[model samples]
Target: MSGLTNNTPRPIDIRLHQASRLLEIKFDNNMECQLSCEFLRVYSPSAEVKGHGPGQEVLQVGKEDVNITAIEPVGNYAVKLTFSDGHNTGLYSWDYLYDLGRDYEALWLEYLGRLSAAGIKRKES
Candidate 1:
């Protein structure tokens, strides 16, 4: 996917609910989403999770209890998420975050399917 464009919707508010382990984000487009920390960690757009090329994605397991320890801004375009597991590489752009929110259900289902196919059971949180 391409980076942010001039028309990209930026987040107007971002709140991290530590107790619930959810990141609630509202965009300028009037769209709001509450993404689980585990979801964000598993779908991280980093080389360690997404890999460096197509078909090289490393399936992220054992992250059912993962949480975001920090949300550091990366200039005006993205935020660097620091996971409790020490993963801090993915630079999540506004476009990508919006997409992740919009496509949450489908993406989550796909991840579950991949795990099932690989016979990897997620640890109960």
Candidate 2:
């Protein structure tokens, strides 16, 4: 399936491995990514985390122990992720998820930099 952009691909499969604390997503184009719950939590697309505008994103710290408690489809375009920390507002669109997967490394490094700049440290469980 095609997505929002011409290059984006729709997700074909999604699996949550609670024991491994990972969420795996496979797209129709055969590209796949395995993301940790901690990463998802910190990069949540919700207003509570991402804020309403650019430069307003709240730096999410202490989410190393966080886990996704549920994944509810929000129609054919997105899924609402419920975090164990009580965050469930972000509706992860197909495009957004694909971007997350494709840009995991850079995004993660950016997150780490933000944390470091903010003098925050992730708390491991």
Candidate 3:
């Protein structure tokens, strides 16, 4: 909901498991989360994905097989994710990442619901 603060949690470890297409992140606060590439790709904060404002988000389809091609740090506050589809614009800040990790289940379910409502399907790999 808000930007990172002085007491915000920071990642202590980040591992990309290419075979599984999951990025495992462990924070200094001892919280750990394994987020799938599809999840990250669909929820990307880039303007291309999220658009310019609320209610402008582009519905991403056929990204179930996307993978993380690279992970680059953005100063000390965020990490830039390079996806297999050549999209690398989102700068995932610590707070954002944490929220993604924390709210993954609900968010994913919501995505699925939206997909179903739109008559779209996640293309299986």
**In lDDT terms, which candidate is top?**
3
Q: Per-residue CA lDDT of candidate 1, range 1-125, in tens?
A: 66789999999898999889999999999999999999999999999998889999999988888889999988998899999999999999999999999999999999999999999998876
Clashing pairs in 1: none
Please list the residue runs of candidate 3 whose C-alpha ends up more than 4 Å from where it truly belongs after superposition.
none
| TM-score between model 2 and native | 0.92
Which of candidates 1 and 2 is the stronger one according to TM-score? 1
Cα lDDT, model 1, residue 26: 98
* Model 3 worst lDDT run, 10 consecutive residues: 1-10
lDDT of each: 0.93, 0.88, 0.94
Q: Evaluate residue 40 in candidate 2 and report its C-alpha lDDT on the 0 to 100 scale.
A: 88
Clashes of each: 0, 0, 0
| Cα TM-score of candidate 3 | 0.97
Task: Give the per-residue lDDT of model 2 (tens digit) for 62-103.
Answer: 888788999999888899999998988888889989989999
**Cα lDDT, model 3, residue 59:** 88
lDDT of 3 by residue, 1-125 (tens): 56999888899999999999999999999999999999999999999989999999998988999999999999999999999999999999999999999899999999999899999977777
Alpha carbon RMSD to native, model 3: 0.9
The TM-score of candidate 1 is 0.96
